[model samples]
Structure formats: C-alpha cells, structure tokens
Target chain A: MTGKAHCYKRDHINTDEIIPARYLNMDREADLAQHAMEDIDPEFVKKINQGDFIIAGEDFGCGSSREHAVWALRGAGVRAVIADTFARIFYRNCVNNGFLAIECPGISQQVDSGDELEIDIEKGIIKNRTKGDQYTFQPITGFAREVIGAGGLLNYIAGKVV
Target chain B: MGATITEKILAAHCGRTQVNPGELINAEIDVIMCHDVTTTPAIDMLTDRGLSRVAHPERVVVIPDHFVPNKDIKSAEMVAKIRRWAKEQGIDKFYELGRHGVCHALLPEQGYVRPGITIVCGDSHTCTHGALGAFSTGIGSTDLAATLATGKLWFKVPETILFRLNGKLGKGVYAKDVILEIIRQIGVDGALYKAMEFTGELIDELSVEARMTICNMAIEAGGKSGIINPDQKTINYVEAHTAEPFKIFKSDSDAEYCRIVEINVTDLEPLVAFPHLPSNGKPVWQVGEIPVDQAYIGSCTNGRIEDLRVAAEILKNRQVAKNTRMIVVPATTNIWKQANQEGLLDIFMAAGAAVSTPTCGACLGGHMGILAAGERCISSTNRNFIGRMGSPQSEVYLASPATVAASAVAGKIADPRNYM
Candidate 1:
C-alpha cells in the first residue's frame, strides 16, 4: 500500500471521533464516510483524497466496537492506518474487513503530514518515501492473512460455509 | 498448570481440553444478541453476500434498543429493516418497542446467559454478561454476519489478568468507582486483548447488578472480556430469570494468569472520569465545582434497578438544581417496572428529573439529550470520549449513578458521600 500520509500526532483516536455516533443512524459506508473524523478534525474529509494514509499515535480506535470506524476510513479512500498501537477490537475489525491497520512503533515521529509512504504489508516494512526513513510493524500472519486474502470475514465465511 | 476460568470456558466451547493465550481457535457461539444499530448492518452484509438466513435462529436474541421508538427517519428505517428481518428469520427471542431495553441488561435479565458458555453481541458492553461467568464479548458487523451464517467465529484466545479486589468500599463508593479506579491505574489499553477476571472479597460482596457495571466497562480498558466465577448469587439470579439448564466452570486453584493486580478499595471516595477518556478518573473531591449541565443515569452499565435505587436514595426529596437537569433511564422493561413499583420513578419525577423508557439514547449521542457546544454532563454511562454524548465541544464526565444524582442536586461535580 502506497499513499500520502496524514499524520495526527495524538493518541486514542476513538471510534466515536472517527465516525461520531450521531451519524451512526446511517450505516451506509458511503454516508458514514462523509462524516469521518468530523468530531476530531473537521477538515479530515476535505484534506485527504483517495489512497491516503492516516498516521496516528498509540491506542488508536480505543473505544466502542463499531466497525463504522473501519468502514468510514475505507470508504473515504484511506489506504491504511499506521499507529503506534491499536485497541484490540479496532485491529480485529480492520483485519476482518480486509482493511489495512498497521501497528508500527514510533510511526508518528517518523512520518509527517503530507509525507509519502509505501508499505510492504507482507514483510511488515514501512518506507517513508518523503523522509527516507524506514520502520517495521507487526506483520499480519496465519489465519488473519487468509481472511484478508479472501477479502474480509464475510467472504471468508461465505467461502467456508458453502 | 491449570487454566483460568476464561481459558477453560473458551477451551470447552471450542471442544478442547486445554488452550493457551494467543492460540487461535474456532468456537461455537452459545448465544448471540442483535440490536438496532449493529444488527441492520449485519443484515445488509449477509443479504449482499447471499447468506441471508440465520444458521441457528434459536440461539439469536433480537432487541432494538439503540434507536428504538425511532429517533429519526434514518433510525426508523434502520430499525424497520431489523424488525422485518427478525420476523422473516423467525427469531423467537425478538423483543420489540414496549418490551425492549438495553441489550446488555436485557440478555442477563431474560436468562439467556449463564455460566460456562459464550455470548456474542454486536455491542461492546456484551462483556456485561461476563459478570455471570459467561465468556461474552462483542463483534463487529462483518463478524456478526459471519457468526449468523456459520454459528461460529474464530478467536485469538486472550491472556487473563487476575484483579484481586479486597477491602470494603467506603461511603458513597460503588462498583462504578472501583472500576474507574482500576482503569485509572491501567490506562485505556492496559488490558489490550486480555481477559480481566475480577475476583476476591469485593466481588463476592457486590450484587450482580454492580458486577455487571464493572464488567460492562471492560471495553474501556481494551479487554477482550471481563469475567467472574459464578457463585450462589449468580445461580440464584439465573434461576430467578429462567429454568434453563446451564453448566458451571471455575478457575483451578493453580490457574495461570498473565498478570495479577491487588486493589484495596478501603477508603476510596466517589470517583469521576473527566472529559475524553474513561481512564482519566480522579476523586470527586478533587473535581471542585465543575458545573454540570446534564446529569444522566442510564445505559447498559448503570441503568439497572439497583442503580436506580441508589440514585433514588440520593435524589429522594431533593430537587434538581436549576443549573442542571437529570435524566433517569432504567435499562430494561422489567427494571423500569420494578423501579416504578418501588416508587423510585415518583421520586425522580417529584425531584424535578425526567424519566424515560430504556434506550441507549444520549449516551452515544444518537438522540434524546444531545448537548450543544461547550455543554457538560455527568453520566453513568461507560465512556467519556470526545463528542460521545453530544457535540464535539460538549464534555462528558463519567460517574456512578449515585454521584450523578448528587451532582444533579448540586448542579456541579460534588461528593456523593454528602448525600449518603
């Protein structure tokens, strides 16, 4: 995955902020995408284009089990989210949806907003193209890889259940 | 080494004799809960994938609590889809508007949960069932879809943390305060991907309602689940609700735990979590007169009958201050009726507070009590994330129902002990 990095040097970007619960009335991924990050950053929807990356600090997506956070980010054309750490449910949601959420320690310091990033998900390597810095992340492995290969849990379930 | 209760339960559900943390396993889902906000999305995904039928409809419980009574056009449409699907699927456990309540509280109250089993829900507080010694946890929309289609889902067995809570709580302190203190010690992600097993003296003395409140916020600490061993109290509660047969499991004396924490709640005061994080808790005395705009007591956490009793005890004969308003929401239909029977509703109304039927409204900012920019509320709900209760500038302070009642009477952050 390669994209322009939109780094937010803060931690605990909860699901409530990623996609506020008020907009949860509309579960259509497309509708939720319009309000993504509306609570934390009003300019988030306006600033980023397709194939952009969200670079964040520790404990990103900390509260709530709403998968709308992943849906909204993916729908907004975000390629991936690189955080220092992740709340477990959010990480699971991303893997289940086949959306990339990379956990790379010190990622927030290495990549600045507008920097370019090229991620080798298979190898768990992140190349900061703008800064010429490189970092490693916990690689997706085993069953999680298989689920992602099948394009999310639903497809995986469909293929298996049938 | 012996396995913890969480491990033993997961191992049993997956048909394994032993399993360790981080090992992946596919477990049979014993019970699943569906609510309005999350269920509709699951239905959409399943229908799109052409797997539109429930594999085990009998095991599924449908309750539309989040936007029930239809908050708006979109919410109404969302719930309409859930209602239609539940009928078409023939889910016998469906609870509609008049009978509906918060998902977490309703599950246990209806006897769908028991010891030594697994419970799944799309709502995070599904962990609330863990108070009954069930290995309950929350899943996302796609996960809900997959579980519905297959009756099974994969899990990465979680490490278990033993929290030995000792000492009797001080005046005005509650299970909510104990949990807040735990979260304060271990930040938001302290138990990431782990199971929190709360045990020892305090849990033994605590009522199931308070235990549910503690387990409900397990998600706030990033836990996979929060659990306790089923004792006589659990069996009694379960029997009172249903005649269903249930197996029981306990952690072996030599059970393995990844970590152990010793908490002494002897003189702990009423606690409150400030804006933006549940882990940002401090003693209410230190909060010093932060004016409250709204004091809310509801949600799966503290909307139980016991919680209502506590709030009513404090709010009795006390009028809500002119500067703030209080909203009391009993968690389930039964809880509401019980509170009404006990005259708690009358006290709230006579005390100049608003009482409503059970809904997760205002807690998630869906509707009913949204705050304007810069407004603040003291809530008995679990979270305090930014804009969690309303506008981005509106802050939410999380406290026990007792503290919320006291703060509502005082119109600011005040010590509940004074009322006690």
Candidate 2:
C-alpha cells in the first residue's frame, strides 16, 4: 500500500490509550475507530489519512487484551503497524483482525511524520519512498503470514473450510 | 525422551503422543471461564453461531466479579444478562454477587481446575491456573466465543523459555518482587508468544498463593503462559480442598528449553513498574518521592489472604499518610471472613484505610475508587496501563502489596524496606 506514514514517535503505547475502556459500549468496529488515540493525542484521528502506517518503539500495545483496539486501528484506515515489538495480546488481536503487525525493531529511527513510505509485506522489505532509504525485515511466521494473507483468523478458517 | 509438566499437559490435551513447538493443535478444554465484563460479548458470538447446546455445560464457569454489587445500572444489566444466559445455557457453576469471587481464586479453590488439563478463559489472567501445572492462557473474545461454542481451542505450541531462580529471598522481598524483577529483565514484549517455565529451589520455597502471583503476571511479560511443575505443594493444595483425584505432571531432567534466564534471589531487591507500563521498572531504592494520591491493594494479582496478612502486619500499629487514601479489597468473601476473624480488618481500619468488600472494585476503574483527573495511585494490581485505575489524566504505579501499604503510610512512593 502507498501512503504517507503517519508515525507515532512514542514507546509503550498501551491498549487503553489506543482505545479506552470507556468506549467498550460501542459494539461496532467503525464507531470505535473515530475515538482511537483520543486518549493520548486528541488530534490523531484528524491527522491520519487513509492507508497510513504506524511505526512505534518498544512494547507497543501493552495492556488489556481488548479487541476493540484492533477494530479502532482498522476503522481508522490503518493498513499496517510496524513496531520494535508488540504485546502478545495486541499481536494476536492484530492477526485475528487482519491488520499487519510487523516486527521491524528499530524502525522508529528511520522515518519522520508525513514521510511518505511504502511497506511490502510480500517482499519482506520497507522502502522509505521519500528518503530513498530502504530496510529489510524477516517475514512473519508461516501461520501468521497465512492468517494475515487470508484477512483474519475467521476468514482463514472459513477459507480453509471452503 | 520424557516431557516436562507443560509438555505432558499439552500432549494430553492435544490427544497426541508428542507435541512440538510451532505445531498447530486443537485441544480439549477442561474448563471454560468468563467474567461479567467480557462474558456478554462471548455469549453474543456463541448465540450467533446457532449454538443451542454447549459441548460440556458443567465444565463452564461464569462469575460476576468486576462489579460485584452491580456498581451502576449498566453494570447491573450486564451481570444480570450473564446470570440469565448462564442459566439458559445450562451452566451449573454460576457465582453471583456475595457468592462469587475472583475467577482465578474461585477456579482452583472450587477444584474445577486440575493439573494435566487445558483451560481457556476470556480473561488474560487465566494463566494464573498454570501454577498448578495446567496448560492455560488468555484468549480474545472471538476465540473465546469459539471455545464456548465448542469446548476446545487451537494453539501453536510455543517454544519453552526456562526461568531458574535459586537461593533464598531476602526479608520483605516476595514472589511479587520476583515477578517485577523478571518483567524488568524481559521487557514487556521480550517473551511474546513464548511459554515461560519457572524452576529451581525458589519455586519449591514459594507458597501456592505466591506461585499464583508469579504465573499471573506472565501475561505482562507477553508470554503465552507461565507454569511451574506440580509437586507436593500442588498435591496438598488439591487434596485439601478437593475430593476428586488428580494426575500431576513434572518436568523431565533432560527436557529442552529455548532460552534459560537465571536469577539469584538472595541479592534481589523489591522492584516497581512505574506509571504507564508494567515493564517500565526500576529498583525500589532508586524511586524516591513519587507521591501517590491513592494506594490500593487488591486484584487477582495480590488479593489473596496471605497478601492481606502481609499488608495487615505492616499496618497494625501505624497510621496511613494523611493525604493518601489506602483501599484494601479482599479477593473473596471467604478471605474477608478470615481476615475479620484474625482481626486484620480492625488493624487496617485503625490505620485509616478503607476496607472494601470482595470485588475487583477499582482494578479497571469500573466502579469504586476510580481516580479523578491528574491523580496518581500506587497499586498492587497487575498492569499499570494508562487509565487502568480510572481517568486518562491519572497515572498508576504497579508494585507489591508491601510497597503499596508502605507508600500509603509514607504518603509518597516508598519501598517496603523503609517500613520493615
């Protein structure tokens, strides 16, 4: 996907910050996305464009294993999340919800906000389409790759059954 | 080629002779658990799948713990729905307010959880049962809904990480501290999707409550589960409360481990996870003058009778800091009664601490003790994630019960050593 990378230059962006527990009442995925990151940075949703990638520092998505966090990101049109590392629950939620959670440890140092970038999960490379800098990362595991490729766990299971 | 307790349990659940890391397997779930807060969603999904009958109705447990007395009309409606759903679904083990306790405490105490079985719960603290040598982990609502419809779960057998702690723990340093130090070493995500097996003399020395505390925070380290091999402690605990027999599992001497992290507990000091992250930690001595507006000691992490006893011992003859509000909530009604009989409640009351009933009152800021804007709290609960204890403007510092009690007395974030 091609888009301006709306990077969040912070560490330990917990689930509560991504989607607060107060919004748990909203059952729909799309409604939850409108308030995503409202707890940390109120302007997050307004500044975000479609198909932006989130690059974070260590321990991203640490906290409660609420699936709404993934829904919020997906609703906000987040295509991929490349972080140094992810909390296990958040990683699983991302995989189950079809959002790409890439492990590009130390990728936070490479780009700035509004820096146009392109991430190719199939090619196992991220090109800094703006700075002319490119980096390689190990591909997601075979099972995780398949799940992401299939759009989600439920989708993957459905596809497998079909 | 013998297997460790974890491997044996996984194999038994997987219905296989041998199980390897990274292999996907569907396993029989011995117990399916849900609380009031998360049960509604799982139930909706289960009903959506046209599931008229549960695979094993008696094996499922529903507990209304988050808002025990139904904090508000909304909380009341949520719990009432769960109780009604459980009855309709033919689940026999439904514990309502006054009868219910924390899911982790009620599970093993009721003898529903035994070794050599796989358990799945909608809550992340489900791994707390792994202290008894069961293969258990938390699942998302979608996966939980699937498990509810069909009493099974799919898992990718993870490589095992070994943690070996030897020597004796110093005074005022307990299992809570040990877990905090472990989180400090293996950042929050270091052990993502890996199994952590605790072994060594220290494991033998720790009590069941202490062991549960260690395994409970395995989620904080980003591990699938934390487990210890069942031994005499496990046997005794099961035998004392349960009449049913159990088949325990132990680790083999030659079982392979992905990585081994060793620690010498004798020299270790109490640790704290500062505001905003469970893995953001430093030694207790290094943290100075971080004031706390509230001090809470409860939750599945440190809400047991033993933990309450330790806090009561420290608060017996002292008064709390005038500015700090200390709240103590027992894990269960039985624990509350036991503390009452032992005069622990009086000790806390005399020290100007509010003793709440058995509920997960303020752990998630769902009800009582919710922090106002810009307030700070030092608590013994798991996860200091933002807005965990209430307002987004507030900050939470995670620590041991002793440290929390001490901080309450000092008005600032003080380690247990200063009081001891």
lDDT of each: 0.91, 0.83
* Top candidate by DockQ: 1
Off by over 4 Å in 2: A117-121, A125-128, A132-142, A145-151, A155-162, B51-53, B418-420
A13: Cα error in model 2, Å: 2.1
Query: RMSD (Cα, Å) of candidate 1?
Result: 0.9
Model 1 agreement with the true structure over A1-162: per-residue lDDT tens digits:
788999887988899999999888888889999999988889999888899999999999888889999999988889899999998888989999999888888989878999988999888998989889889877988999989889999888888866
Q: Any runs in candidate 1 off by more than 4 Å, and if so which? A: none
What C-alpha lDDT does candidate 2 achieve relative to the native structure? Answer: 0.83
lDDT of 1 by residue, B292-411 (tens): 999999999999999999999999999999989889999999999999999999999999999999999999998878999999999999999989988899999999999999999999
Where's the lowest-lDDT run of ten residues in candidate 1 chain B?
B63-72
Model 1 chain A: ten consecutive residues of lowest lDDT = A153-162
Clashing pairs in 1: none
**Residue-level lDDT tens digits of model 2 in A2-114:** 77777776877888789876666454678889999888888988988888888888778876767778888878888888887787778887887668888887888888888
- The deviation in Å at residue B5 for candidate 1 is 0.7
- DockQ list for all candidates: 0.85, 0.42
